[model samples]
Target: MLAVPYPYLIARMRGLKRGNHNYYKTLRNYTHIVAGSPFAEKVMRQAYELTGTRIYKNTALPFAWDLLQEERQQQIRREFTNYFPQSEGKKIAALLVFGDISKMKKTPFRNVNMQELADSIGKDWFFVTNSQELAEASYVLPAEYRERFGFVNRIMPTQNLLYIADSLVTNNCRFAGSYAIRRKPVHVLRYTGNVFEKYVQEDYNDMYIGQIDKEMVKIQSGQMRPDQQAFCKEMSYDNPKEPYGVIGEILTKPF
Candidate 1:
């Protein structure tokens, strides 16, 4: 069967033995394995050395491309505003795609004070985050600012909120790759997790939160421009064919 491993798995492979690890053995069973970016491909190659495993492709196919279209972005903005009316008059900033409280210990946001972040971000912005994240900080979050933070009880896909958000603040998760497509400013909290060195160093949109307000203003005002093309290159978006077309060719052809 074809396998499209998560980007993190590619990073983790760096710690595995060259040819003897169970994960590498399991990977051997797949007819084809895909890496979503050049950074991922490099890691996979280094980790899988002497194991007879190789990446079949490097393409970013899983991103929400349709959502980035202008018409769709407008529709999403309307839908988002309808659901969170507090966002109607204000610029929206989002904390994205985190799951359980226990899992957070592994990321840079583990020690971040969400209440302080909220207070420091100023009054012109409304914040969106998951319920669990809100609850994790709510006890300490002031009552007046609590209204500025909104969340849905049910599962709200990160892309919809991302489409309308003026900026994003997130840990180094795969979902943060959407910055390449969205071309917005993303303030990445610090963590030296297992990831490509170039991926962390070269991307223009990713930054620390030391002076978040000033950084945000610079980004929006074009003083700090993000190089979308450079970021896309890191994601291996160089293939001339559409990503779906490339995937289809791989699936239908002899392996």
Candidate 2:
């Protein structure tokens, strides 16, 4: 069973409380799946049973889009450039592929074109709605542009897709992670208990890795900028024995 940290869950609930009208509407829709009417205890129970946590089903997409907004996107771009200055002048592409363009149109996926977007960004970024469409888009791109573009397929299993999508948003709209393969096709899977479990575990692992990264920054603080050191400290791991001991062992080994 996937267990989100209590703080994360509480923060999500707080966001839900402050969400806009559409967020509530989406919540209401999901709440209807249970025995009782929306917002009833039975509905909540059903939600817990299905997802292992209470979350507004519809809020994730909008939240993802919010993270992809112009300001956030630019911030992400800036961070990326700062980290990889050599990529500063490179074009970032974004492509969106969809199983049913019509269905996407009804949602935030409306009017987004993979090719046009790639051209607009003037970067090696691409977003695709589905794997098949991504393949098709890759085939049609101009030879020059093709080399600079990267594709993001959205048709992963719903849960995995949402997790990836959320990460993309949280990570300044960058696409990462893997989706399942089906006969060479890919589909987004809806969020599920197991998927959520994996998501939490992955996040925890990322946090732990980030902590270790911070310790490295501290060790190199004399060489790193003050601001960089500060940023690294925030991500520092709580348990340093493992890392410290490993390094000590390596350095002291006779072999």
Candidate 3:
């Protein structure tokens, strides 16, 4: 069996001094490992070197492809509206919340009140979030916002929802890369959360820089014009093709 760890984990490992000793050691046993970026590949190679284990074959590729078909946009929009009737005639903005780091009692996190953020952006737009985000938000988000926003509790593909969404709002979210295929306006709220904040406190050599506050006036007005090409390139998603086919070809044919 092949090992394909999440790229975020690999990035976190790269941020660490020794790349989490035992984890990479165990990864040596896999026949092949897939890396999502050059940085991720570098992390794995360094880890294998430290363990004195032979580094297996691996390739760095974009995590997701352009699954947003042009023809399917309307179909997806209609399907989305069935679930989120309030979203009709309003631009959809996806608020991606991975974990409630702000309300945690374990450590002091820069207070991130998502409620206020959502309220500021939802003037003419409607919001959507998954069940996990909604659950985490219950502690901070009030009932009005919760009731107003659409909750995708089912096993629907996120790409489909994003296909219909006009903008994205994320805070320390893992699947932010997936949304990069669309190259729409994205507001990155939080990055320094979880163990990353700890790394910052210890004054370690951290590469993860926190980007906060996109202009709310532009974002809410649907006038935000970010460099789409640059953002896609940063995520290594400029080409946007199915990754599995590329991986298969890489395994079968020599470079």
The best candidate by lDDT is: 1
Write candidate 2's Cα lDDT for 1-255 as tens digits. Answer: 111122333233333445521222224433122111112222234323342233322111222233334565565656545543544565322222222334343433222354554454344332223334445656666766565433334323322233222112112111221111001111112112223223323433321112211221222112333432232222221221222333344357464
Best by TM-score: 1
TM-score of each: 0.63, 0.26, 0.58
| CA deviation > 4 Å runs, candidate 1 | 1-7, 13-26, 29-34, 49-58, 97-99, 102-116, 131-147, 153-155, 190-233, 236-241
State the weakest 10-residue window (summed lDDT) of model 3: 204-213
Give lDDT for model 1: 0.54
lDDT of each: 0.54, 0.30, 0.52
* lDDT by residue (tens digit), candidate 1, 167-245: 7665544555555445566555333333432234434434544333334333333222345345445544454233576
lDDT of 3 by residue, 13-44 (tens): 64556446544454655444554443345556
**Model 2 regions lying over 4 Å from their true place:** 5-111, 124-131, 151-255
Model 2 compared with the native: what TM-score? 0.26
Model 3 off-target regions past 4 Å?
A: 1-26, 29-34, 38-63, 71-74, 100-119, 131-148, 154-160, 190-192, 195-218, 221-232, 250-255
Enumerate residue pairs that collide in model 3. Answer: none
